[model samples]
Structure formats: structure tokens, C-alpha cells
Target chain A: SQQGEEDPQALSIQEGENATMNCSYKTSINNLQWYRQNSGRGLVHLILIRSNEREKHSGRLRVTLDTSKKSSSLLITASRAADTASYFCATGGQKLVFGQGTRLTINP
Target chain B: SAVISQKPSRDICQRGTSLTIQCQVDSQVTMMFWYRQQPGQSLTLIATANQGSEATYESGFVIDKFPISRPNLTFSTLTVSNMSPEDSSIYLCSVEINVRQYFGPGTRLTVL
Candidate 1:
């Protein structure tokens, strides 16, 4: 069974608009990580936040983790057409279990 | 973070045959993993490859169908045996150092 479940399975936004995706997990986790995958491609690690951390930022990406709610969100600010891809959230244990993912399309 | 690489980015194989996918990491990593992503599905962990030890297979996955080899800390291979049309999927290799993981470009296999 998958530990993480992401909401709004798909999204469409204009270039330079912000896109937000949410994920919820069922169990406790030491860390939560986000990844991006192009169509029929491998995953690229985006960011990871520890259980103790509430928020993290990397360039145009901002991730917030609320362990109390067992949820996390990834926000892409000032999105670009290049940012169009599938985004997944993975909860880590012995292995990482990924969510179904959110497909984001950036209209130019 | 690590730079991971996989060979034979994509291939088409006949049913009942087998294909071996290789993964190499620039730096030694304690834990490596193989994952399968069927078309239109999320990634699923197949096994955890540990250097100098037997690989740990996940539920719904077995060693007979997906044999793995982690000869060293920096290298590993996953062989999809007795390939079937159902085996067509993307196989990815990942290395974990501490809490961070880096993935190799996947091997896209199509079993005809």
C-alpha cells in the first residue's frame, strides 16, 4: 500500500503563476521528500524536510511539513514552462513510498 | 547527493527472454534500491540492494522474477527474468547516502 496520497491529481497554470500540490501520509515518518519526473523518465529529487522541520525553501520551491497533520505541501513560485512535470511526495522509512503524483502543466 | 547512472536507457525485448539493467554511482553508498513504475502508475519499490548481502525484496516482488546484484558499494544490477508483456515498465536505480537519495535515469523496458 502507498503511504502518501497527493491531492488534485492534475493542475494547470500559466507561466509565472504559483502552483501548489498537497500530500497526506498515513504513518509516522523520519523525513518527507518531493521528486519530479518528466514523462516516461526517472525521478529527480526536489527537496527533503525532516520530521522536526516545519518548512524549507530552495530557490523557487518552498515545502511545508506539518507532522501533526501528517501532511506536506510543495509550492512552486513563479513557475516556468520548464516546470511542467509530474510531482510526487514520498514518505521515507526503510524505503520511500511515493504518492500517485500531481501532473502540472504550465501554459506559456 | 550522488551522481547515479544506468546503462541501456531503453530496450525492447522478446517475451520469455531476460534483460539486465546496470546502475553505477560515483560515490559509495550504503543503500541502493530498485523501483518499477508501470505505465500510468506511481513508482513501486522492488528491492533494497545492500553491498555484501542478499537483497531485500518488497511485498508483491520476489527474487526469482527480479534478481539483483550489489557487488560493491558503488555498483548494482537488476535482471528482469522471464520477461512478459506485463513486465514492460521503467526500472530505476537509486542510491541513498544518509537520508538523501539520488536516482539514475531509468531503463525503459518493453517486453513484446
Candidate 2:
């Protein structure tokens, strides 16, 4: 079964704007991770937030987890054209389960 | 972080034929995973391969269709059997290191 579902399947924004993508999962997880894929290539791990932690920050990326709602959101500040790619959210369980993903486009 | 490599980055095969994709990791790992990403879609895990054991497949997937082999901690392979056009997709292999998962470049398979 699919564990995560991301909304706003696609988003297009200006380079300096902030992009926010939300993900919701069904089951309890030890941690939730964010990944980025460019041009259908390999995935790059971004950040991971444990169930015990509500929020995490890495560079210009910010992740927030709400365990009660079984949801999480990733915020990329001052996005660049290079940030254009597919963003995926994965829930850690017996195995990693990926979300549908958000296709983000940054207009320069 | 683990540096992983996959063989035959892309291949074109006809229906009824099979293509075996190989994955090799720089560091020894206990578990390796195979995932499929259909055209314009998110990734779906095909199976989890553990060294010296049979692969555990997820629902909607079976060993017959996607046979996997994990001979050692650093190497694994997945073969797509009896291919069809629907089987065209990117197959990726990944391993977890320091609890964080890293992926290979992936094998792009196109079945005609």
C-alpha cells in the first residue's frame, strides 16, 4: 500500500519565493524523510525528522512533522532554478514507502 | 553515505525477453532495496534483498516477475522477467548507511 501522498502535484514559482509541499501518511513511522530527484535520475536525500522531533532545518530547507495528524511539510526558502525537481516524502517503516511526489518548477 | 553503482544504465529489450540490472555498493550493508518508477510516476518498491536470504517482495509484486539476488552485502541484482511495454521504467537500487538511504543512478529499461 502507498504510505505517503503529497498534495499540489505540481507547483511553479519565482526563484525567490518559498515553496512548500505537504505530505500525509497512514501508519506510524520512526522517521519521515525528504528526497529530491532531477530529470528522472537518482534520488538525493534531503533531511530526516524523527518521530520524537517536530521540526528540522538544513540550510534553506525546513521540515515540520505533526505526528498527531500523520502529516509533514517541507519548506524551501529563496528557491533557485536549480531547485526545480521532483520532491518526495518517505515514511520509514519496515521499508521505505514513497509519496506520489511534487513536481516543482522555479521560474528565473 | 554509501556510493552505489548500477550496471547497464539503460537498455532496450523486446517483449518476452528479460534484462538483469546490477547494483554494487561501496560499503557493506545488511539490506538493499529495489524500486521501480514508471513514466511520470513516483517510485514503488519492488522488493527488499538481504544477503544469503530470499528477497521479500511487496504486495502487487512477485518474485517470478522480478527475481532478485543478493549474493553479498555489497552486491545485488534484479531481473525483470517476460517483459512488456508496461514494464518500461527506471529500476533503482539503494542501501541504508548510518540509517540514511542512498540510491544508485538507476537502470532505465524500455521494453518493446
Candidate 3:
């Protein structure tokens, strides 16, 4: 079974705007990781937030995790056209289960 | 970070034919995973391969349909047996190191 479910299956935004994607999981997890995949390419690891961490940031990316709610959110500040891709959230434990990613499009 | 490579970046196969995808990691890893991504769909875990043991497949996947071999820590192979049109998808291999995982460029398989 899929452990995570991302909201807003697709998102369209203009460059310089911020993009926010939310993910909800069904079970407890040691950590939650976000990944980005370009067209016809492999997935790239973006950021990881542990259950204990409520929020974390890296450059333009911000990840917030709410263990009590079993939900997480990823925010990309000043989105760029190059950021157009599928973003996935994975919950980690004995194994990592991926969600049906959110496809983000940044219009130039 | 570890570098992962997969052979036969893409292939077009006829139904009933079989294709084996190979994955090699630059560094040894205890845990490796295989995932399949259908067109416009989320990735699904196929199995977990560990060195020196049989691969453990997911609930929906079976050994007869997708046999996996992990001979050592750095290399593994997943074979699609008796393929059909429904088997068409991108097969990816990933290796876990510490807490982060690195993925290989997937193999795009088209079964006609």
C-alpha cells in the first residue's frame, strides 16, 4: 500500500512565485524525504525532514513536518522554470514508501 | 554520495520476450531497491535486494514475474519475464547509503 498521498496532484505557477505542495501519510515514519524528477531522468534527492524536526530549509526549499497530523509540506521560494518537474514525498522506516507525486509547472 | 548505473537505458521488446536490467553501484551498499514508474503515475516499489540473499518482493509483485538477483553489495539484476503491454514502464534501481538514497537513470521498457 502507498504510505503517503500528496495533495493538488498538479500545480501551475509563474516564475518568481512560491510553490507549495502538501503530503499526508498513514503511519509513523522515521523521516520524510522529498525528491524531484526531471523528464526522462532519474530522481534527485531534495531534502529530508525527520519526525522530530518540525521545519527545515535548504536554500530556496523549505520542508515542514507535523508528526501529530502525519502531514508534511514542501515550499519552493521564487520558483523558476527549471523547477518544473514531478515532486515526490517518501516516508521512511523499514522501507520507504513513495506518494503519487505532485507535478509542478513554473511558467516563464 | 554513490554513483549508480543501469544498463540498456531503454528497450523495445515484443510480448512474451524477456529483458533483464542491470544496476551497478560505485560503492557497496547493504540495501538496494527496485521501483517501477508507469506513464504519468507515481513510482511503485517492486522489491528490496540485499547482498547474499534472495530479493524480497512487494505484495503485488511476484518472483516468477520479476525475478531479482543480488549477487553482491554493489550489483543486482532484475528480469522481466513473459512480458506484456502492461509491463511497459521505467524501471529504476536505488541504493541506500546512510539516510539518503541515490537512484540510477532508469530503463525505459516498451512491450509491444
Candidate 4:
């Protein structure tokens, strides 16, 4: 069974707009990480938020973790056409369990 | 961050045949893992490949079907045996460094 579940399976927005994706998990995790996958390519690590930490930021990416709620969210600020991709949230433990990704399309 | 690479980015194979995919990391990593992503689905762990040890298979996965080899810290290989149409998926290899896992460009396999 999958540990993480992401909502709003797909989203579309214009360049410069902000995009957000949410994920919920079933088990306790040491950390939660977000990844981006371009079409036909592998996953690229985005940001990681530890259980003890509530928020993290990296360039245009912002991630928030709520261990109490067993949920996490990824927010991409000032989205670009190049930002079009599938985003996944994974719960980290002895092994990382991935969620069904959310596909984001940023139109120019 | 680790730069991981996989060979034969994509391939088409016939049923009953096998295909071997190779993963090489730019730096040595202690834990390497293989995952399968069926079309329109999330990634599913196939096994954990550790250097100098037999690979650990996940539920519903067995060595005879998906054999893995981790001869050293920098490299590993996964072989899909007796391929079937249902075996078509993207196979990815990832290496764990600290708490983050980096993935290689996946091998897209099509079993006919």
C-alpha cells in the first residue's frame, strides 16, 4: 500500500502565478521530501522538511510539513513554463514511500 | 548530490526474454534502490541493493523475477527476467546519500 497520497492530481496555471500541491501520509516519518519529474525523465529532489521542522525554502520552492496532521505541502512561487512537471511527495523512514504525483502545467 | 546514470535509456523486448539495466553513481553510496513505475502510477520499490550483500526484495517482488547485483558502492545492475507485457514500465535506480535520495534517468522498458 502507498503511504503518501497527494491531492488535486493535476493543476494548470500561467507563468508568474503560484502553484501549490498537498500530500498526506499514513505513517510516522523522519522527514518528507518533494521531487519533480519531467516527462520521460527521472525524479529531481526538490526540498526536504524534517519531522521536527515545519517549513523549508529553496529558491522558488517552499515546503511545509505538519507532522501532527501527517501532511505536507509544496508551493512553487513565480512559476515558469519550464516549471511544468509532475511533483511527488515521499515519506522518509527506513525506506521512502512515494505518493501518486500531481501534474502541473505552467502556460506561457 | 550524486549524478546517477542508467544505460539504454529505453528498450523494447520480447516476452520470455530478459533485459539488464545498469546504474552508476558518480560517488560511492552505501544504499542503492530499484523502483518500478508503471504507466500512470506512482513508483513502487523493487528491492534494496547493498554492496557485498544479497539484495532485499520488496513484497510481491522476488529475486528470480527481478535479480539485482550491487558489486560495489558505486555501481549496481537490475535484470528483469522472462519479461511480459505487464512488465513494461520505467525502471529507476536511486542512491541514498545522507537523508536524500537521488535518482537516475529511468530506463523505459516495453515488453511485447
Candidate 5:
């Protein structure tokens, strides 16, 4: 079964705008990871937030985790057209369960 | 993070034929994962490729349809047997490091 579910299924924004995506999961997990996939390409690890950690940052990306709520959110600041892709949230356990994903489109 | 590479970046095969997709990591990794993403669908874990051991497959996936091989820490392969149109999807290989997981470029398979 899929553990995570991302909200807003799709988001359209202009370049330089900030984009936010939310993910909710059903199980207790050790960590939650976010990944981005370009068209016809593989997934690239964007960020990871551990259960004990509330927030983390990497360059333009910020991830916040709320284990109590079983949810997480990814914030991309100053988004660009190249950022258009499918973003997924995966919860780690014996195996990782990925969210349905949110497709973000940055209009140039 | 490890640099992962997959062979046969993409392929078009006839139904009933089998194709093996190979993944090679630049460095050693203890755990490797295989995933399949159907068109416009989320990724599903295929199996956990443990070096020198039989792979652990996910529910709804079996060793028969998708056979996995992990010869060592840096190399693994997944084969799609008796391919059908439904088997066409993007196959990816992944490995984790310091809590972050990296994926291969993926192999795009099309069965007709």
C-alpha cells in the first residue's frame, strides 16, 4: 500500500515564485525523502527529513516534517522553469512507499 | 551519494521477449532498489537487491516476471520476462547514502 499522499495533484506557477507541496502518510517512519523526476529521466533526491527533525534546508529547498501529524511539506524558493517535474515523497520502512506525487509546472 | 548508470537507456521490444536492464554504481553500496513507474503513475518498488543474496520482492511483484541480480555492491540487474504491453514502463535503480537515495537515469521499455 502507498504510505504517502501529496496534495494539490498539480501546481502551476511562474518563474521566481515559491512553490509548496504537501505530503501526508499513514505510517510511522524513520525518515521521509523528497525526490524530483524530469521527463523521461530518473528521480533525483532533493531532501530528506528524519522523524526527530522538524525542519531542514538545502540551498533553495526547505523541508518540514510533522511526525505527529504524519505529514510533511516541501518548499522551493525562487522556482525556475527547469523546476518543472513530478515531485514525490517517500516514507522509509522495510521498504519505501511513495506518494502519488505532485506535478509542478513553472511557467517561463 | 553514488553515481548510478543503467544500460540500454531505452528499448522497444516485441511481446514475449525478455530484456535485462543493468545498473552500475560508481561506488559500493550495501542496499540497492529497483522501481517501476507506469506512464503518469507513481513509482512502485519492484525488489530490494541484496548483494550475494536473493532479492526481496514487493507485494504483487515476483521473481518470475521480474528477476533481479545483485552480483556485488556496485552492480545489479533487473530483467523483464515474457514482456507484455503492460510491462512497458520506466525502470529505475536506486541506492541510499547518508539518508538520501540516488537513482539511475532509468530504462524506458516499450513492448509491442
Candidate 6:
């Protein structure tokens, strides 16, 4: 069974707006990672945060991990039309277990 | 980052037949995994491909139904044996590089 539970399965926002997606996992994890898949294609690694780290940023992506709560959030700032894609949060390092993804649509 | 590729990006196979998807990594990797993703669904881990050994399948998955071969560090193959319509999904192989993971272009299989 999948261990991660994600919220807001779908979201629509205007270009330049900020988008946030949350994921909560049932078990303790050593790290959490985010990935984006476009048009049912191969996934692109977005960002990964270690359990010891609270937050990390990469370009327009900001990810925060709260190990105490076993939850993590991904924030996309200044979202662009190209950011329209399905995003998933995965737990476990080598044998990753992915959560049901959040579909984000950036309306231009 | 690792460069991974899977052959026969997509295929339509007849029921009861089998299809083998090959995954090749640019560099040698210690860990490789296979996953199945149904339409608009999350990825479900099928098994872990351990080099020079049999794969470790997850719950509900077995070696006979999905036989795997990891002949070396940079190459692995997953075969969907005696496929059924329910096996229609995107099969992806990924490699773990330096604690990070990289995915290959998925092989979309449709068992008719």
C-alpha cells in the first residue's frame, strides 16, 4: 500500500500565482522528494529534502519537510503556464513509494 | 544526474503474450527499480532489481508474472509474462545514483 497521502488532488491557478501541495506520510522517512510528470511522461526530479532539513529551495520551487508531523509541502512561486503538470511526492530513498499526485493547471 | 533509457517506448501486445522492456543506464548504479503507473494514478513499485540476483518484488507482485533480469550494474530488464488487459499501464525503470533517483522514459504497454 502507498504510505503517502496527498491533498488537493487538482488545482487551477493563474500564471504568476503561487501554488502549494501538501503530502502526509504514515511512516517515518529518511528523506522526501518531489517530482513532476508532464503529459503522462517520464517524471523529472524536482527537489529532495532530508529528514534533518526543514526546508530547501531550487529556482522557483520551495519544499518544506516537517518530520515531526510526517508531512511535506511543495510551493511553486510565480507559476508559469509550463508549470502545468502533475506533481507527486515520494518517500523512501531507493525504493520510492509515490503518493497520488496533484494535478496543477496554470491558466494563462 | 543519470541518463537512463528504456527500449520500445510503447507497445501493444496481445493477451497471453509477453513483452520485455529493457533499461540502460549511462553509468553503473547499485540499485534499480521497476514501477507501474496506471492512467492518472500514482506509481506503484513493482520490484527492486538487484545486480546478479533475483529481483525483490513488492506485495501483490511476483517473479513469475513479472520476471526481472539485472545482468549488470548498468542494464536491467523487466518482462511482463502472460500479460492481461489489466497489465496495461506505463512501466518505468529507475536507477538510484548517489542516493538520488533518476527515471527512464517509460514503456507504455497496452495488453489487448
Which candidate comes out best when scored by lDDT?
2
- Which candidate would rank higher by DockQ, 2 or 6? 6
iRMSD for every model = 1.1, 1.3, 1.5, 1.2, 1.6, 0.6
Model 6, stretches more than 4 Å misplaced?
none
Pairing residues by index, what is the TM-score of model 6?
A: 0.98
Q: For model 4, how does the per-residue alpha-carbon lDDT over A1-108 read when each residue is reduced to its tens digit?
A: 688689879999999999999999998888889999999579999988889999999999999988889999999999999999999999855477999989999999
Calculate DockQ per candidate and list them.
Answer: 0.77, 0.70, 0.65, 0.73, 0.71, 0.87
What proportion of true contacts does candidate 3 retain?
Answer: 0.54
Cα RMSD to the true fold for all candidates? 1.0, 1.0, 1.0, 0.9, 1.2, 0.9
lDDT string, candidate 6, A1-108, tens digits: 897788899999999999999999989999999999998878999998999999999999999999889999999999999999999999988999999999999999
lDDT tens digits, residue span B4-108, model 2: 999989999999999999999999999999999999998999999999999999999999999999999999999999999999999999998877899999999
Candidate 3 colliding pairs, count: 0
In order, the B-chain TM-scores come to: 0.97, 0.98, 0.98, 0.98, 0.98, 0.97
lDDT of 1 by residue, A10-95 (tens): 99999999999999999999999999999868899899999999999999999999999999999999999999999999987558
Question: Where is the poorest 10-residue window by lDDT in model 1 chain A?
Answer: A91-100
What are the per-model numbers of colliding residue pairs?
0, 0, 0, 0, 0, 0
Residue pair clashes in candidate 2: none
Which prediction has the highest DockQ against the true structure?
6
Query: For each candidate, what is the lDDT?
Result: 0.93, 0.94, 0.92, 0.93, 0.92, 0.93
- The digit string of per-residue lDDT tens for model 2 on A1-108 reads 678689879999999999999999999889999999999999999999999999999999999999999999999999999999999999865378899999999999
Judged by lDDT relative to the true structure, which candidate is superior, 1 or 6?
6
State every prediction's TM-score relative to the real structure.
0.97, 0.97, 0.97, 0.97, 0.96, 0.98
Residue lDDT tens for model 5, B7-94: 9899999999999999999999988999999998898999999998899999999999999999989999999999999999999998
lDDT by residue (tens digit), candidate 3, A1-108: 888689889999999999999999998888999999999578999998988999999999999999999999999999999999999999864467889899999999
Can you write out model 5's per-residue Cα lDDT over A1-108, one digit (the tens) per residue? 778689889999999999999999998889899999999689988888889999999999999999999999999999999999999999874367899999999999
Give the Cα error of residue B10 in candidate 5, in Å. 0.4
Interface C-alpha root-mean-square deviation of candidate 6: 0.6
> Mind giving the per-residue lDDT tens digits that candidate 1 earns over B22-85?
9999998878999999998899999999999999999999999999999998999999999999
Evaluated at residue A69, the lDDT of candidate 1 is: 96
